[model samples]
Target: MFKNLKNDLPASIVVFFVALPLCLGISVASGAEPITGLIAGIVGGIIVGAASGSKIGVSGPAAGLAVIVATAIGNLGYENFLVAVVLAGVFQIILGVFKAGIIGYYFPSSVIKGMLTGIGIVIILKEIPYFFGIDKNPEGDFAFLQVDGENTLTELLKVINALISGNFDYGATIIAVIAMAILLLWGNVLSKKGKFFQLVQGPLVAVVIGIVYYFLTKDSGLELSKDHLVSVPIPDGLSGLKDLLTFPDFSALTNPKIYITAFTIGLVASLETLLCVEATDKLDPNKNVTPTNRELFAQGSGNIVSGLIGGLPVTQVIVRSSANIQSGGKSKASAVIHGFFLLISIVTIPTVLNLIPLSVLAAILFIVGYKLAKPSTFKAMYDSGWMQFVPFITTIVGIVFIDLLWGIGLGLAVGIFIVLYKSFGNSHFLHKEGENVDDGKIKMTLAEEVTFFNKASILKELDQLPENSFLELDVRKTRYLDNDIIEILEDFAFKARERNIDIKLISERGIIENPDSFIEFFKLKKPTE
Candidate 1:
């Protein structure tokens, strides 16, 4: 892993710069202490990076889980939420052991795109209040409803009111605009100018500028207060640092809600990790495919360690992983090195870190959100046709109006329905050219895979055949013929005889003229067991 120090070492610094603001920003978004995000970043890098199969994939506190973490903390309390993170690690370990990493493949691409877009929209909405400097408990809940008797839309309304009344924080707003402008210019323009610009990310620059802005504008009307800046509790020494660490509340083990939150975190984290792993592998110059089950185990271990020390849930994050790859990372050593950087920064520069404006972080997240939900993405999905567009749109609306899980669930439900509907219509092919209209003969070829879902379509075709017809039932290409379908054919054989219809059954085994029963024919030699 350390063989490529010349390349990996430099790449690690770039990844560190990329991950720093994200860790802190996601923490604030998740309603957790800033230190918790840093802790998760540390564990995810050192522990998960060590255990992961991928040579370059980076792990950290993910923005995708910000909404869930925030809601969980609000509902279960931070201590109880820690218990969930621990249990979530256990669940992820179980999923890895059971080789359930393939679960990620079952989700339709449309649904996944929808999930990302929905989360992106929510992030933009939640961060707007902070961007405008109306920082009222910037816990960053993305849910439509909040515990403070206000919801996302209501809060947005308040921001509009603040704007109309000219009562917003001018200082924070100014910093945010500058920070955003820098991020935009750095990412879109400067980064293309040279390698130095690529190695030094926009978020880090925005954060440093925000700190400088805070110090320079102190005591002025445009000065941002502590509430508008990051709030990292400074530790005095070794003992003080240890005192800052929080442990899971074991008493919460008896609480069912803790288990529910754990399962949600585990499931969602696993999904996100698997998706990032796939994307990172694609981005790899060597095109290496990480062992997904091993990746799950590594993430599980990271989350366990992170939770034990008051950190948000950890997952393989695409942003950090992509930055690592683009910066010439050649091995996991880069990831481990980045973790040490995070640790050193917190230990040596807590005061400087605390000066970073929350508005600046909000601006960084604004770019993140925009990338996830680009207007072109929606247009492309719409162009993909209704099969893809329906579930995609459904998921976005569900996520915007409801919660993260509900949105994915609704999208999956719609996807499944669409699949079933198509399955029902495509049960078999009745060859037009093969039809002997003068003799009332029909040749029907069964689909490659016919399940019970195809029963209605197949039955309708069979019933519509003319009386005294010669039916040629072909199953040569059928790899899977469900028992339900066999039974349907068995029943139809009896009706065919009464209607004076002669049935010819063709299979890989042989051809049977007027088969007495399909159940007995295919039952003895099923195409696929």
Candidate 2:
């Protein structure tokens, strides 16, 4: 791991920058302390990464779980919810031990596409408030499309109006803009040519700029509220650790509602982690496959640690994972190292971290979101296949129009429908084998399992069977023949007796005792043969 430090350090720094905003944003979105996100990121990197068997997977506070966490807090109270998170982790570990990791594989590719696209769209929408300095609760909190007199677009319009009409604080706005500018400059402009800029990230730069700007603009008597910037309580001295550990009252665990919250968190967090891990693996340059079982275990441990420490539940996150990969991470070491970095930095330099401007973080996420929702992404999905394109678009629309899980669920449903439609449709094989028009042989083999979809084609082929000539109806490979097709074969078999047609079925799983039902299955009203 040390040997890869040269590569890992740069990747770690990039991941740290990428994770900073998401950690804070997702936590805020979950109605938890912004520090909870940071704490999750730290544990994800340090503990989860170390324990994880996945080579390149990075874990953190997941946006996918933001809604679940938020609702849990609202329903069960924050204190009780913390206990649920710990329990969720325990559940995940049990799942991993059972080798349930392969469940991630069952999620359709289309659904996965939809998930990534949805997340991309959601990131952009949620960050809009931050980009303009409207200063909402947090970016991830936009799960339900907060009830305005109108809708999301209208509320967003109001936020825009506030920004334009000077209803928003200019001090925060100016500093945020400066932070964004600095970060962008360093990322897109300066980092290419310099070592220091590469060593330090644009978000950190924006944060530093925010601090400098804050001090420089303090005398302006701006209406900037503390809520606009980073807001973790900075306790004094080593004694501060006491406040970090938040204990949940487990006495109420017997409540059905608490159990419901625990199950919800466990399931949602697991799904998110699985999805993000898959996406991140795809995004990884090396294309390394992470061990899903160990990923679950790591997440479970991280959540357990986080719950005990007043932090948020954790999951593998694509945003930070992609950043880790693009920044050139070599192994899990970079991820583990970043965890320590987060822990040490927050503890030793809380005042410094608090200086990070929201706008600058927005700028950072703005880049991440762009990479995700890029125009090319749509083109790529469209090029993949109809199944891929459908769910991919649905996911994007769902997240943009409703919520993350809703979009993914809709996409998942569509994807599953496509799969089942194909499976049921492929139950049998269609053949056009009669004395050929050109060479005396035309066989259009149908699938093993035929359905109504193949009926038209099969009927067409059977109609063209040479009259009183050499006709071979081969059903050797077919397993389960649809009733409609079975009837067609039955009629054909009876009609072939009137001609010189020969029927043959070559299937191991096909009907042996009831081979006669092969034709009766279709039961054509008028046997043309």
Candidate 2, residue 310: Cα displacement in angstroms equals: 2.6
Candidate 1 regions with alpha-carbon error over 4 angstroms: 1-34, 54-58, 61-84, 248-268, 275-288, 317-338, 425-529
lDDT of 1 by residue, 1-529 (tens): 8988877887787677667767776787787787898899999999999999999999999766887888999999998999999999999999999987766545666776787788778778878988988955654455566546678888889999999999999999999999999988987899899877766777778888998899899888889988887666688855678877999899989999998999999999998898677556645776565888898999999999999989999999876787788667999999999999888777777788778788887887787678678999999778656777899999899888887667878988997897676556564533333787898989888877765445445656877899988988888878766544665577678778778999888888889999987866875775534
| Count of steric clashes across candidates, in order | 0, 24
Residue 108 shift from truth in candidate 2, angstroms: 2.7
TM-score of each: 0.71, 0.75
Expressed as tens digits, the lDDT of each residue in 1-529 for candidate 2 is 5678877887887677677767876787777777788888888999899999766778988776776777888888888998898999999998899877766755655566566666666666666677667755555443546422234576578778896787866676676666667766777789898777777767666666667776676667753456666665576655785676677778878888877887888888898888777677656665455778888888899889888777888888777777777666888888988888887777787787776666666666776677677888788667555655887788778877877778878887776676576565453455444346764443445456664345455655766677645444455555545443554466556566665565555444443322455533332221111
lDDT for model 2: 0.70
lDDT of each: 0.80, 0.70
| Best of the candidates, lDDT | 1
